[model samples]
Target: MPETRSYTLDIESLDLDGQGIAHHDGKVVFVDGALTGERVVARVTRRKPSYDKAQAETILRASAQRTTPPCPHFGVCGGCAMQHLDVAAQMAVKQRALEDALAHLGKVRPDQILPAMQGPAWGYRHRARLSVRLVPKKGGVLVGFRERRSSYVADIRECRVLPPHVSALLLPLRGLVGGLSRPDRIPQIEVAVGDQATALCLRHLEPLTDADLRRLRDFGEQHRVVWWLQPKGPETAHPLDPAQVDALAYALPAYGLRMHYRPADFTQVNPFINQALIARALTLLAVRPEDRVADLFCGLGNFSLPLATQARRVVGIEGSETLVARAREDAARQGLADRTEFTKLNLFEVDAEWLRGLGYFDRMLIDPPREGAFAVAQALAALAPAERPRRVVYVSCNPATLARDAGYLHHVGGWVLKAAGAVNMFPHTAHVESIAVFEPSATAA
Candidate 1:
């Protein structure tokens, strides 16, 4: 049987995932619902040879940073982890986590840390995937985030992270799904909100009856939300009522750019931080009218189009042919086609020869996924001196990978780690979004 004993621990610090770190009986204990510098009585829920996991049974002493979570389902819902921590404190912790990842994993440091990018702490998540389950035993269908550290669906009435209008649909959604003919077959719902409209893409494992479709349309009309249905995969999603809503899009007024994306496409969850990040990246790159810039892993020309506004020419390379086509269309519509060119290429396998084929660029911007851009960095490092970009800006969703790539660029590629900082794109969550600037070393230049 698992250990069921309770122990008192003095919380020392927080781990990368916001779990409180404590030492108990010569072993490391990770206690949930505990804050740093607090004394808590915790019960061991799970044990391992290296570390143990526990739940705080009682808080003997609380930290000043602790606050009553505005969401009643904070502890039970897996959507957020650090809601109990003060908003400013949450940003500070994320910044520290980024610095720690860079130091320990990458063996490098930035010359300066930029200010943390922050926005409204609540009602900021423009996109989310909510789980749906039919629990007839307890009540009816449950629609929300999963239970913390468990596979079960959380019983939540509302979600504060979603926009006010979207949050108001939670209970209504539960009722709508519960009354469906195949309530148990509906597995999940994808929520995407744009400045103009809100959409719900329902993922159903079974075919919906005519009656079910009518009910879904009714719910959409009642709640002023567009209904999309996915019979199997993301590609199968389409509008239930074709004439109801326009294509989803967001605007970056600073750059005079509008980005239209499909519901399943990967876009930033927080529009506020996304705009800030783009502005900061462009400023760091220092693009000039005479400069030729390259945007690697550029999805739908998010950065390429904006760069075109200032650069002599901008070349965007991405892996998805569909996204490349969309980007090309968007650039033309925005009257930027003359200065912008997009190509489809898998960047993960990019090498020195591939880099040279792209020709010389004065500046470059890389916004890679969680795996980071190690291959891109290595290729850039191997480029001929005359062909290498003078400056590069990297946007990352994972700090560990960012740090590793930064170390390679700074140490092996002879690049200077000029500045780096964290972006609070996901408030109350452990996910860290950061950006960094790099320049060629004096000798290399």
Candidate 2:
């Protein structure tokens, strides 16, 4: 191989992936393991016409925001990208990302920037999907997240992002898998840590023998965890023995609510941050006691039930039938069934006419997936002043989509972007969760 070229570069900014950006001979270079305002020696790993990818070899000047990563597998594990940066700095980067997306992609800016919502950085991940691989060369069974960019699993003995009790099971889990009847048949382990108990869903391609079941039982007994086996899809996942495990649920004590979820369901990964986000979203929504509210793209009644506690009526619209059913059940369980209604609808395909059918809502809360709520935004924009909700609180996972939708709501729909801010849901990752509030423009006809 030809000698690799090395460049001394000054890191200028951070990309969405938390990589450092530097200019090299008029081309953009993305440097891994480097921070903004730092001068580093980087080795060109891949070159492109417009941009290049590099790995930082040495830091000539360290940034004040830089801090030692708490996790030993920080650089190697793709599970987290911003672990090396201080928690405050991580929030700053995410805030910048949200602002940039809103200004550049959405062409709208919030009138006020809400203070960043924060929670515990370490041991905050309540849910995670760990990759399992039987690599004889590496050892026996290697279990952890995939390597930074490779498909290979990182040999992680402990994960700082996981709760201490769950993290302690990593090595034992490796042994458990390695001794299974068909070690190679297992692909991944889905971890869901609830308030009362920890559950692990093992995805195995082949059947487990009686011996394998006994071993799993013994592991669960020893570790005080519940074992769920998934032979096929997520729907097929069930506890090995239902009597041995407590139902998986997380408590939102402030609301006196316990939200039940399955291992495969899409609940917020950080329970603490999720509680904070819900409170912030609701406060931004400013629901009134007599108001009829709409929770669009609501999952598992995460927000709807809380809204129902205050609002006279709450209608939740979701694309997933399963989630809708679960949300409805949760509403009934919470005694909010009389106030809340959930319906299955692909919010992505909705238009103005369809939104009108739901009647007028005094306030609306939107918590969309990464795709954001473009169709719903358009529908809301197209509604007449009398038909539109006076205020909207949009909770978004993708800042770009939120910005785009916010821009349309402001520039096209005659709405005002009231306030926006980042929520540090995944503190050690580049994932930006944001909440933006909107209201009809004062001058709109």
Candidate 3:
């Protein structure tokens, strides 16, 4: 139990949740956006005997790491939190955040901490889902991210993290939506990037008129972007017409491979970071010429195709039958079908015995959803020492779940945490994309 009373406190540390944790009068205090080495007076927002939350309204002295934010809607827009902090400082804090989480929650630490991975701070986000609103009381349509911790959309015109073209389209999108018959009915706008062009998917609640269709088509031609309209479910999305303009695709230069994906599919938003992450994960996996590798939750064969170049065979498992068939087609197109295998399985609820009957492999790499591949990881951990893969490379988007799963493998599976590090996959934001390597204890030393 903690002391219950109103007391002014100073922030000591920043948690991974983007909140600063400190102590006052023997009670834990969490202050929003208050960094270390800075003194601030905050009011208690919530009180539990053990811990309390506070809101910092003023900063008497700001940290040197803090800087002027470019976006006017910095605090109001929920898209990013650390934009005010210097880039290097932000990465350092994130590194500490991961370290703290592991030490405090997992009761363990990796033997080695890999250098944190950093990338372009601005114009790095290649993917985003923007929200739309028509607030009659306020004005016309609101075309941007939702307000910080609120359902109301932020009244924004430019985003520093988005690519220039995407940023430039916001104001125009607002005007265009204002022109729509039911602008408020339009809920989402999904953006995806392919190798050659950018694509936008408009999710509307009602059918569009011929006039509305003409405007969207005209906008597509003028901006040189592909326009897709989603009237119902995800499967219902399609191009405005027969000719697909500005098809988004990305290239993997190391393998001379080019792959195409729809905007809604899972692809790394930062090309540079994605490539670097793939290279790092492969190095950790250490694929051998004769080694067979398993890539669980592999989407569109991003890691599978790259693994084929080094491994004797690469097996990719995904939950979507559509994605599985598409991966198979991609493997065939690349003429790597002989080296790559595709399967559809619910990674979250896997059949351990059924997977064991399939044979074995030397290495495994997984890039699962935000859920963190709990079942798949647990099953892999349960395999006999002789049957289990020797090494694993995990790329994760959520820190808490990744740490939780990491604990299970290290504590229960007789494995050693070799190395864990952070990647600036989503800069200026609270999202931390990280990769970790685990190895058999005997080989770890």
Candidate 4:
């Protein structure tokens, strides 16, 4: 076996991917499992001309922020990083990640930094997809997260981060899989929670035997969680019991809203942060009774509903017809049908004329996926400096794209970045969810 080369370096900061930064002989090295202000010995994993990748071999000094992770699968499971750090430390790392992206990539920063959004650390996940693997040598199946740095599934019977009910189903699901003829071949389990009930979708490689179906049905009746069997892709997912006893939904009590979604629909796992995000986004919009607001890429009217509370009318545009229909239903359910309108459109390719055809809207609230709204943002950037929206609230999942779009809005759109902040949507991971507010230039009107 080749000996692993070791180097001692002082950790400077953390990168967006949860890697630790260290300057070794003036070359910037990023070491995994290292923290800021900690001196450690690292074994180089991959070497590059300008930098290198390493794993912390020895933490000669550890930060006070470091904590003993609760899960036994901490290091071995590839599901989460930052588990070894305190929640406060996790928030700090995320904040720095946002700041680094803004400074290094965007070359611009918000005039004010809003407080970081934080939430419950454990059992907060409303949705999850657990991997399923049958390891006959150990037991019947290894079901849970992937193993660290490997595709192999981590044998996790209990997960502290998932909602207690969902976590409790892991072992039973594993046992149930064992009863299946092709237990190992049966792939993953997806858990999605709605307001009234929880739904579990199990992906199977082959049709279930009659006896296997009975066991699954019995488990479903006992657990109160609807079981969905997926023989093919997500579209093939159907209830193990077609009685329609359970429905998947999530609620925004503040807005008197409850949304139903299929198991595969996009919903925030951390419900608390999402509620706060909706509240903050609407607040930033500062919607008035007479204001007309446009919710670009709106799904299920999460932001649109809240905006309707303040604005005179809210026009929500989404890429999927299903989501638009769902949003319309939600609007009717909330008695905001007259105030909120839903439209299905490709947000990526929209323009001023297209938007004008829909309606005249002065305020814009956008929440784009990880790809970000390159085209939508570019159009916003091209809006005449004198005719731009008075306020725009942008929510994003990817910081790089947010920064890229921010650069265009700040340098091109003649908008002032009022405030920006980070939200801890995915705890213990490097993913940063954030919102930014941009106001038109003072003299634009």
Candidate 5:
């Protein structure tokens, strides 16, 4: 067993995970529930060769930026990490973390730090995969997020980050699952909310009985929420009552577009922030009526369809055939079939030859997953001066990967890191969503 000891330390800074960083006897210590510039008594929870992990036992001195977390389940639930920190301070911390990652990991910095994107901190999460556990010892079925650093399900009555209607379903969900025939077989619930509808995709390990379907329908009717059953995988999900429920969709009022997505399809977790992000990205790309833009890793054409509104032509490329088909269908529905086109390709394996075949683009929009776009950067770097896009806007969820790719664009591709900023998509959480603009150095001349 690890030895436990208490130490009063002054928090010097915060780590990327929102934990307070302090030094005790020359060893770095990470303390949870502690804020920077605060003095706190912490109990060591774990020990390592170079650093220690602790939980704040008592706050002797508090920082002005610290605030009382509104969520009752703030500490126990693993969903959010920085609730105790003031909202403004939370944004500042994330911005600093992004800059630190860029400087230290990528050896590059942007010319200007764009103002951080802000949105409603609470009730912003529109997508979440809630864990469902039937623990008899912990009182019947438990529904919500998992316990912090534990495998046990958190016994949360409600969540502040989720939509109000969805948050109100926690207790009811627990009861619904508890009364089911095979409560233990139900492993998880995927929540997806759009402007018009809310969907709950229940993942059941074993086959659900006919009675189970009836119960789900009854629950959906009571809550006025759509129900989807996932017996095997995401591809197996289907609506309980397709005839009664409308397809899940969210409108981008600014772009005059509405995006349709399945419950299992990937969409931004925060709709409001997504709207602001799309606007900012489009502005940074500076699309003109005659401009032709390429959107790489364009899942469901979230950016492509919007770009088509301003740009003369937009080509969206994705690795998933399903997403490409959906993008094309959405484009056609939006009467943008003439201005937009989508293709399915493995972007991770993209080469200069493949890129050249796609034709010329004045600007490029890349919203890659956490792995980043190393291949895309390499392909752009290999392109001749005449064929390369003049400007590129990168939307990233991981700052480290974004910085690395930014470095490649700057050092290897001879591009300039014009500007970058953080978008607080998942507020009160450590997940950083950011955007960066890169242009050829020659453009400055």
Candidate 6:
């Protein structure tokens, strides 16, 4: 139990969640809406044996990095966490957090820290899942992200992270949904924006009436957006009229590539940063024309296709059959199928033997989910020096997991941490994306 009374505390640092950390009576306290080096009066919201959670009520002293949030629904909406902090400060904090994780958790340090990759601070999100709820007391319906620290949907007319056109559709979408046969039945709307068109996938619990279908068509026509209906799982989602929809795709002009993907398929949320990341990853890989490369956990061949353009042969391994099939199609469309191979395999279940059975790779690219490719790291560490890839470039969405795997690679596998840096994939949020390069140590080789 926590005391209802407020207490004055000094914020020492910012945690990974962007909450300020302080010490009170020998217990750690996490204070929301506080910045590092700020003294604030906070009231405890929840308590645990080792720590307490609080919300800052009054700022006795404000930090230089603190700024007024641009979004009106900043605190209530869970979409953006560090909007109150200056954009430059946000990137600096993320970089520091990455270095700290590498040093403290991994007990390894990069020989060189690459410059933090950055891009636009607003209207950069290309993919998002908006929540929907019907509340008669407050309003007819609410459509936006979930509230901070809550499951309830936040009432927002516009989103700062979404594109200007999509943000403008928020109110229209609310009306569009409220007029539906069962507004409450539609629990979520997934947004996917491509270079040419935008898509809105409506997840309904029950079958929609002809009137509801007509409303969707009218909205789509007026807004110039596609409507996808999902009565059940994500796979069930299909465009109401595929003929009217433009093929959802993004272009990598540098590689002369245009990658197509379904609305439900996994793609980077930030297209600007995705392009920069791919260029950086390829540079770090130093792919030679004769090199045989392997892309682990490749989704939709984002990296494999690009690598295929440079490498003699590129092998992509993924866990999902659907993603593998799509990757193959994309490779064929890009005219890289002859040089690229797509395989469906659970990388998480692989070991040294399984990895060795696949033969040798000159270099490898790893773009895994937040779980951080621990099993793959273990397999690489278990492999003989001759069997291991000569070089590896890892792209991660989680700093902590990247550090853990970096530790295993450096400490146990005799790999050198050549370079690592943070990527600002999601601006104004606590999320930290990073890239690292590793090579076998001279002694081990």
How do the residues 26-118 of candidate 1 rate in per-residue lDDT, one tens digit apiece?
899999999999999999999999899999999999999999999999999999999989989999988998899889988889999999999
| Per-residue lDDT of model 3, residues 120-189, tens digit only | 9999889999999888887788888999788989999899989989999999998888897778789989
Model 5 CA deviation exceeding 4 Å by range? 244-246, 443-445
In model 2, residue pairs whose N, Cα or C atoms come closer than 3 Å (at least 3 residues apart or on different chains), thus clashing, are none
Compared with the true structure, all predictions reach lDDT values of 0.90, 0.90, 0.83, 0.83, 0.92, 0.92
Q: Which pairs of residues have clashing backbones in candidate 6?
A: none
Candidate 4 residue lDDT tens string, 257-356 = 7766777667888888889889888878888899989999998787888888888999998998878987898788778999988888888887666655
lDDT of 2 by residue, 309-332 (tens): 889999998888878988988888
Model 6 lDDT per residue over 1-445, tens place? 4478689999999976779999999999999999999999999989999999999999999999999998999999999899988888888899999999999999999999999999999999999999999989877889999999899899998899999999998889889999998998989999999999899989999999999999999998899998888999878878899774446889998899998887888999999999999999999999999999999999999999989999999999999888899899989887999999999998888898998988999999999999999899988888888888889999999989999999999999899999999999999998999999999887873
- What candidate 1 gets wrong by more than 4 Å, as runs, is none
Model 1 vs. true fold: TM: 0.97
Q: Which runs in model 4 stand beyond 4 Å of their true positions?
A: 1-3, 243-246, 443-445
lDDT of 6: 0.92
Kindly report which residue pairs in candidate 3 clash with one another.
2-49, 194-248, 194-249, 195-249, 195-250
Candidate 6: how large is its RMSD?
1.4
RMSD values for the candidates in order, in angstroms, are 1.5, 1.4, 2.9, 2.1, 1.5, 1.4
Q: TM-score, each model?
A: 0.97, 0.97, 0.93, 0.94, 0.98, 0.97
lDDT of 5 at 108: 92
Q: How are the candidates ranked when ordered by TM-score, highest leading?
A: 5, 2, 6, 1, 4, 3
Q: Which stretches of candidate 3 lie over 4 Å from their true place?
A: 1-8, 43-53, 443-445
**What is the alpha-carbon lDDT of model 2 when measured against the actual structure?**
0.90
Between candidates 1 and 3, the one scoring higher on lDDT is 1
